[model samples]
Target chain A: EPEVTQTPSHQVTQMGQEVILRCVPISNHLYFYWYRQILGQKVEFLVSFYNNEISEKSEIFDDQFSVERPDGSNFTLKIRSTKLEDSAMYFCASSGGKPQHFGDGTRLSIL
Target chain B: TQLLEQSPQFLSIQEGENLTVYCNSSSVFSSLQWYRQEPGEGPVLLVTVVTGGEVKKLKRLTFQFGDARKDSSLHITAAQPGDTGLYLCAGIGRAGDNTDKLIFGTGTRLQVFP
Candidate 1:
């Protein structure tokens, strides 16, 4: 079956450094989302994108975070000046509607 | 904010045993989805329940939505070792602005031993 794919399975960065996570959603999907899971914690929704713009975002998605559909297929999340609390597993998801499909996820670790 | 709470945060059982996991919320949802995640992987959708009091079956697994759409349950019959994973339930709710977002549950980790 077709699936969403994310790049950089794992990443480690300094607390003040910038990082960008990339994802390629399923070809036919129109809605894209970014979610994060802290170790041993529940998954948290960050943002949702549709029609080349942000449809909605959570409080966790602050000024430090941004998302972009840079191309027809590529969706990316960028964190400016990462903080220790930013460490988590970031998952990308896509959906035509109802059921959303997820990617394997990228583990982001900030030192 | 809408929140989903899952019971029995962790469970361990022998192969061929049956188990159930629950997801509950005080707020109503338009739909609910169940997902399973293995170590180092993102959640994989297992089922979606849209209507109140709806029941869906997938082989040895069964899912039921509450009559009020505020809760759901997943039951596994004769579960196998392969059923071991973290199960998560997410509810779709409309925010104040009328946009829908998924609110995830606390999660239930299941371990089936062979």
Candidate 2:
């Protein structure tokens, strides 16, 4: 079965540094999303993209965050000036319909 | 903000036992999907229930959506150690002008012992 895939299973970055997490959504999927889960917390939605542009975003998706489908097979989330609180497992997902498929996730650790 | 609450965040059970986990919310969903995640892996799709009062079965697992569309349950029968993992419930928000948004439940972590 086709699945979403992400790069950089783990990343450690210093405060004020920039980071980009990349994902390859399932082929033929049109809707894409980014969500993060702090240790022992609920998954929080960051942003959703469709038609090569963002469709919606949550409050957690602030000024520092941006998403781009830079190419046919790659979607990326960039965080500028990482903060300690930015540490979490970031998951990339795509949906053809009701159910969404997810990537293994990139665990971001900010020091 | 939509909130989905899952009960019994952690569960431990013996092999061959049966167990159930629940996801509830105040908001109604147009569709709900269940997923299972293993350590170091992403959630794998299990089932999707679109209509209220719907029941779907996969192997030894069963899924049910509440009549009101505000809740759902997953039951694992004759559970084995292989069934141990985190189970998540994600519901799609009521569609508006073709936008498909989702809210995920808190998640239930189940450990099946042998």
Interface RMSD of each: 0.9, 1.3
> Candidate 1: how large is its RMSD?
1.4
lDDT accuracy of residue A77 in candidate 1:
98
- C-alpha positional error of residue B101 in candidate 2 after TM-score superposition, expressed in Å: 2.4
In terms of lDDT, the poorest run of 10 residues in model 1 chain B is B93-102
Please write out the lDDT profile of model 2 over residues A4-87, one tens digit for every residue.
999999999999999999999999999999999898887777899989999999899999999998877899999988999999
lDDT of 1 by residue, A28-106 (tens): 9999999999998999999999999999999999999999998799999999999999999999999998678899999
Q: After aligning candidate 2 to the native by TM-score, how far in Å is the CA of B3 from where it should be? A: 1.5
Question: Model 2, range B9-112, lDDT digits (tens) per residue?
Answer: 99998999999999998878888889898888888889999899999999999999999988999999999999999998988875442446567789999999
User: lDDT, candidate 1, residue B6?
Assistant: 95
Question: Candidate 1's residue-wise lDDT over B94-113, tens digit each?
Answer: 33436556789999999999
TM-score of each: 0.96, 0.95
